[model samples]
Target: MNTVKELFRGNIRQYGMVIALLFIMVFFQILTDGILLKPLNITNLILQNSYILVLAIGMLLVIITGHIDLSVGSVAAFVGAISAILMVDMQMHFVPAMLISLLIGALVGAWQGFWVAYVRIPSFIVTLAGMLLFRGLTMIVLDGKSIAPFPKTFQKISSGFLPDAFGGKIHMLTIIIGIVLSLILVFSEWRKRSTQQKYGFEVGSGALFALKLAAMVAVLNIFTYVLATYEGIPNILILLFVLIVIYTFVMNRTIVGRHIYALGGNEKAAKLSGVKTQRITFWVFVNMGVLSALSGLIFAARLNSATPKAGVNFELDAIAACFIGGASASGGIGTVIGAIVGGLVMGVMNNGMSLVGLGIDWQQGIKGLVLLLAVGFDIYNKNKGVS
Candidate 1:
């Protein structure tokens, strides 16, 4: 019982958001007459929220480094417009067009990063300027018009699904993949626990560990089953999974990640300890730029067009997700998984309300309230910890 309490106390934020997510899902499921978790809706949920999730991941890093990027939405719009010019107006291949767009994103990042890192400008001010600059550029690039009918290959980036290897009513491949993932998750957790025990670290009880593992595996399988019943897993889901895994590893296990946390925690101390604060800060922005570009591409692909308002207010959603997922508003604290969870919370709420015939105005108001409550919750926790 004591170990359980300790475990819960140690990971309250993570466990809390997860429980909240499940509770929200259940609440909506009941209210929607079981339509909330329908396989089709679940698939749509993933597709609709993919771009935001990507931004949330990148935004997590920025927030962790005690900074924010207000220009991601505009950057995304700009990149999408450029891609449209390359692929549609210029008749270029989607692959090369995408690569060029990403490169442009890097350049944009470098531009902003230079100001923030070297010129000693506040990130807020720099990105605010970038937001306006990029949005205007997007309008200029597209001539204030929308472009459409992206190549089918490019369209697949957002809309395509994995082909079924076995001909069946249900997607066997998805099921197999689910099982494989479950096994890997279990093995990894077990190994982590064993290592902690070996190192004399505080570890949860066997029963508690078993319970957690069971819950995770069950959720993973159930999610996969739903996808299998539909059109199977999406290509974008694969991309998201890969990105999550990579960023999670980078944040949790890498020296660079530690340096970022250190820098966020205290720039002075980090610099004194030989961490290249300027370089890290610059690269982090560069990373954000690339992810923003990718998100723009995905959004453009989904809509089959690059519009003037392609990424309007995307930065707000991404920022809100980070905070809701337990990121500290003052920075130096957050996780990649937490940001994703936060994004899902918002996505689920949006879908649920839409299903319930809620007005858009009310939806926006509710979301604003949720964001406030989430940030408030974080502040409350921080104060409690300090006290």
Candidate 2:
């Protein structure tokens, strides 16, 4: 019990943020007269935030590695334009076009990575240049036109929902998926606890662990139920889920993940320790490019078109999500789950404000204040520790 309390004491910030998220949800749920968590609204929430969440996952890593990619939004727009040109203008298949676009994105990553990791340029400058470069390239590719009315198959990527094989009003598939995921969550938590105890590492108590697991199961089941009542699940939700799980593993359970943390903690030290700082840094941007490209496709599909202005301010959004999720301003900290939660915070606020018919003017101001407070909170805690 004491160990569990100690764990909570150490991670008060993360848990506090989670509590804040819940508080906001409940507040909005009441303010909107229960429209906030309606089945339809819940589905829309996932779909709306799916692309940003994807970017957040990548941004989390880049920030952790002590860098930022200002070019992701432009990269997404450029790749999305290329996808439209291939599929619509040239009448190519979406799958092949998607593959090609992803490759191009990777190459773009490699290009910027070369400048940052090898040539020793600052990331902000490199990606800022990349942001302009890709935006210009997107306009040139599309001739400043918005390509629209994608094929049914392409549109399905964003708008399609999983079909219920059971054919009942209650989404049996969603519930089943929820059950499977809950079981996995339980098993993983138990194994992790056992391993930590075996190694004499500090761990939350078994009861705390159980309670957390129970919460996870409950939330998963509830979210699944919400979707089950509506369209079962959005296809993009699956993509986001896969990404979150993969990234969570990569950051928590892999050697590369450890190396990233090391580099972020102290670049010179990590290099002396043989962390291959350059290689890791180079690959980080490459990964960002790939995700940007993927997001471009998803965003374009959702809109049913590729617009020249498709990705305006997307980088800002991604950066905000990372920082709001508790990523340090100086980097070397943050988590995949934190990024997701942060993005959701942004998404929910955007949604709730819109539901209340607030103007864009007020929305932007409120959001800005939230971001400021979030970062401010982190800075306060940081300084307090030193004091």
Candidate 3:
């Protein structure tokens, strides 16, 4: 009890946002007359927000580097349009077309990175120009019209679910997978804690650790159950899961990750310390491009079409997710999990408002309000010198 209290006292904002997410979920689950958590709706929510979550991961890195990419939305749209032209118009194989689209995305990132990292242009200016450039290119590629009905194989990337080999209506595969994942997660945490203790690193109390572990395991199983009752897991969910794990590892454990934090914390100081600031910044943007491209592909697959407006306001959503997830505005602080939870918050708000029959006008207003409050809270905390 004391340890849990200490943890909260030191890091209330992170846990607080998490609790707030739960509260929002409950509120919507009730306001929608339980429709929000309906098996089908849960699946829809995953599909609807997967791309945003992907964008958020890359956005987190960019933010931690004390820069922003305003063109991810436009880049994604451009990539989607290119993908459609390659696959549908040119009749190229889906796999090769995807590679080509990704390559284009990387090239675009390199282009922006060159300006920001090498030429010393502000990221804001570079990506803003990219926003306009790619948007125009998307229009040109699609000829200012929507492309449609991608090959079934491409569409399956977003809509398909894993086959249930358990051969039961309850999705035994899902349940089994859930249980195994939960156990693995818990065991991994335990081992990590043990290792930390051996190294004399800071470790939380057993009681607090147990409490946190149980909650996570429970949520894992419950979420799995919800999906199992519907149609098992969407393929996008698998991709999202893998992405989350990989990014979390990179951010928490890698030297590059530490360098990014150093740069965001104090760029001049990091450079003085012999960090390759320019190269790091350049690669960060390149990584952002790759992610934006992947998201573009997923978004196009979901819609079965590409349009000039396919990525409208996507950058804003990704940025907002990072801020709402407890990222510091000035950078040097954030977690991949926080960004994901933030994306979920954004997704829930959109879903809940629509379910309650709010007009599009009201939805936008409400979303804007949420973004304002989130950033405002962060600014307040920083001023107060809270962790």
Candidate 4:
């Protein structure tokens, strides 16, 4: 019993969010008369939350560096407008247009990074300016108009999915993919444990490791099943998966990742220890810009058009998701998985409420309260040294 309690203590934030998610899901499942978990709605939940997950991942890194980004949403909108102009008005090819949009995002990041990192401006100020600047640029480019009917290839970025095939009754392809992914994840974990053991660090027990692998496999299988039941796995899902893996690895295993955490934990100490604070800050924003662009493209593809008002207030959702997911506002502490879970919780709440015919007013108020409680809990836990 003590051991189980210790496990929960060690993983309190994760478990907390997971418990909240389950509770909300169950409550809404009952409220909606069993419509909350319909395979189609479940799949849509994943699709709808994918962009938030993307922005959340990048936001995690930025927050880790003890900073915040208020411009990701505007940057996304700007990229979507550019892509629309290039594809629809200028009649550009899909690949080049996409590349240009990405480049524009990178440039926007670089611009903000320069002010925040090199010019010694506070991130809040720089990003506040960026929030306005990019929104203005988007309006200028789009001229308060909507662009539509992008090329088919571009539409596939979000709407396309793989066929359900591989073996027989099951979505063989999804199952196989899940199994392969599980293997890769387990192998990676094994390697990590081996490395820790070699370094004479406390490697978790063999049984613990096995249990972890089992949990991962179970999650993958369940997710694949849900997607298979709906319409197969989406291409955006694939992209989101790859980014998660890559970013997770970076945050967990790489030197740069360490630098980010170190900077977040204590900037003075990190700088004293020779962490390139400016460079890392610049790169973090650069990565944020790239992901924002990618998210913009996905959003456009999903809508089958780009509107002048795309991505309004999206930055708030991403920030709220990160904070609600156990990230410290002061920076230096957060997890990629935690951010994803937080985004999913918000997504599920929004979806369930909508399904139950809840009004926007009540929904907003409830969500705001939930966010406050979550962040307040984190602060309380930190003060109590609960973890």
Candidate 5:
């Protein structure tokens, strides 16, 4: 009984968002008369939430280091403006414009990182200042006007679907890819458990393991089906996959990832252990800046324009998603998957409410209530030792 209870606890955090997702999916399906799960809408939903997922992954790392980044939305706006200016005003090539915008983002990150890490300023303060500074710069750079009509190659970053010519209408192929990926993930999990078992560490129960894998496979197959039925997967989804793989590896396998978790768990201990807490903090922000810039570029590309208000209130969405996805407000405990789940929850709610013809005011109120519930439940679980 104790083993079973512990297994449940260990897996609770992993499944909470999944459960919430299903609940929302069912509710919306009923409300929309089953339109919510229409393959095309499902495909669009994934694409729509892709930017927040990107930001949340980076933000999760930053938060895991006991820091926060409030400047990402503004940085994205600045990057969008820069990309537009380069391509439109200067007639620069797409590749060069992208590189230059990304470089500017890196430099901006370095600036804020230096202040927070080396100058001993609080990250919250430094990034808050950056928030204002970058927003103003975005306005100045774009001269308070929207820039439009980016080149097709540049605009394709967010709006393009994968070329069906390469793999033509093959839902079976997509399903096969998902199955292979699932198998790889399952084998990896089994190896890790076996290693732990060898060391006399308790592994989760067989039941729990089966439950987790089954859930993963179900979701993966459903997602694959949706994309395959629609546009055969988006280019942005491919980019998101690459990022997830890279970031997951970095967070799980790399020394930097370890240090970040350590810093979040205990700053003084991490500093004493030669973890270079300050440098890690610095790089985390730098990375956040880069991802923000990328998100901004994609947002601009998706709209085929850069506007003064392109990223208004975007930071709140990212932060809310992180918190809702199981990030501890007190810091140190969260996952990339959690953030994505949180973003999806928010995205789904938004999409569903719109489908049901909820006015903007009601939607905002409902979303706020959901956020409160999620964070409140997370706190309750922590205090109750439920997870």
Candidate 6:
């Protein structure tokens, strides 16, 4: 019992947000007459929120380093416009167009990073300027008009699904993939626990561990089942999975990740300890740029056009997701998974409210309130911890 209490107390913020997400889902599920979790809606939820989630992952790293980027939405729009020019006007293939767009994103990041990291400007100011600059550039690139009708192959980036290997009523491949993922999850957790025990680290009781594993496996299978019943897993989902695994590993297990946390925690101390604060900051922004460009591509693909307003207010959503996912305002704290969870919470609420016939005004207001509450909760926890 005491171990359980300790565990929960130590991870209250993470656990709390997760529980809140589940509660919100259930509440809406009940109110919407079970429309909240419909397979079709579920798929839409993932598709609509994918870009923001991608930005959140990159934003998490930025926030951890005690900085912010207000220009991601504009950057995304700029990239989308450029891609449209390449693919639609020049008649270039989607593959090369995407690669060029991503390269452009990296350059944009480098530009902002140079000012913020080397020039020693505040990130807020640098990115604010970038926000206006990029938005204007996007408009210029598209001639203040929307570009449309991208190649069909490019369209698949946002709308395509994995082909079913076995012909049946349901997608058998999705089910098999789910089972494989579940087994990997279980094995990884068990191995982690064993390692913890070997190192004299505290771990939950056997029964508690088993219960947690069972719950997780059940949820995984159920989610997969729903997708299987639909059109199976999306190609974008595979991309997201790969990104999550890579970033999670980078953040949790890499020296670069530790340096970022250290820099965020205290720039002076990190520099004194031989960490390249400026270089790290530069790279983080560069990373954000690439992700923002990727996000722009995805959005453009989904819309089948590159509009000037393509990424309006995306930075706000990504920022809100980081904070709501338990990222600290003072920095040096956050996780990739937490940011994704936070994005999902926002996504679910948006989808749910829409289903309930809420107006855009009310939806915006409610989301603002939720963001405030989430940040307030973080501050409260911090104050309590200090006390």
- Which has the higher TM-score value, candidate number 1 or candidate number 3? 1
- Model 2 ranges with Cα > 4 A deviation: 1-5
All candidates' TM-scores? 0.99, 0.96, 0.97, 0.94, 0.94, 0.99
- lDDT against the true structure, each candidate: 0.95, 0.90, 0.93, 0.87, 0.86, 0.95
Per-residue accuracy of model 6 over 285-354 as CA lDDT, tens digit each: 9999999999999999999999998999999999999999999988999999899999999999999999
- On the 0 to 100 scale, the lDDT of residue 6 in model 2 is 65
Candidate 4: tens digits of C-alpha lDDT, residues 1-387: 565567778889878897888899999999999998887888788778888889999999999899999999989989998999899999999899999999988988888998989998999999999989989998998888888989998998888887765645556787678778888888988898899899998655687779878987897788788776667788888888888889888998899999999999998899999999999999999989988998899899888888878888788889989888889887888999899888988999999999999999989998899899988998899998976
Model 5 residue runs over 4 Å out of place are 1-5, 165-173, 205-208
> What would the C-alpha RMSD of candidate 3 be, to one decimal place?
1.2
Where model 6 places Cα greater than 4 Å from the true spot, the runs are: none
Give me the displacement of residue 237 in model 2, in angstroms: 0.9
Candidate 3 TM-score, true structure as reference: 0.97
Candidate 4 contains a number of clashing pairs equal to 0
> Which residue pairs overlap in candidate 6's backbone?
none
Mark the 10 consecutive residues where model 1 has the least summed lDDT. Answer: 378-387
lDDT order of candidates, top first: 6, 1, 3, 2, 4, 5
* Residue 68 miss distance in model 3 (angstroms): 0.8
* lDDT tens digits by residue: candidate 3, 1-387: 677777886886678679878999999999999999999999999999999999999999999899999999999999999999889888999999999999998999999999999999999999999999999988888888998879999998999998897787888888889999999999999999999999999889787789889999999999999999989989999999999999988888999889999999999999999999999999999999999999999999999999888999999999999999989889888889999999999999999999999999998999899889988988988888888
Which residue segments of model 3 deviate by more than 4 Å?
Answer: none
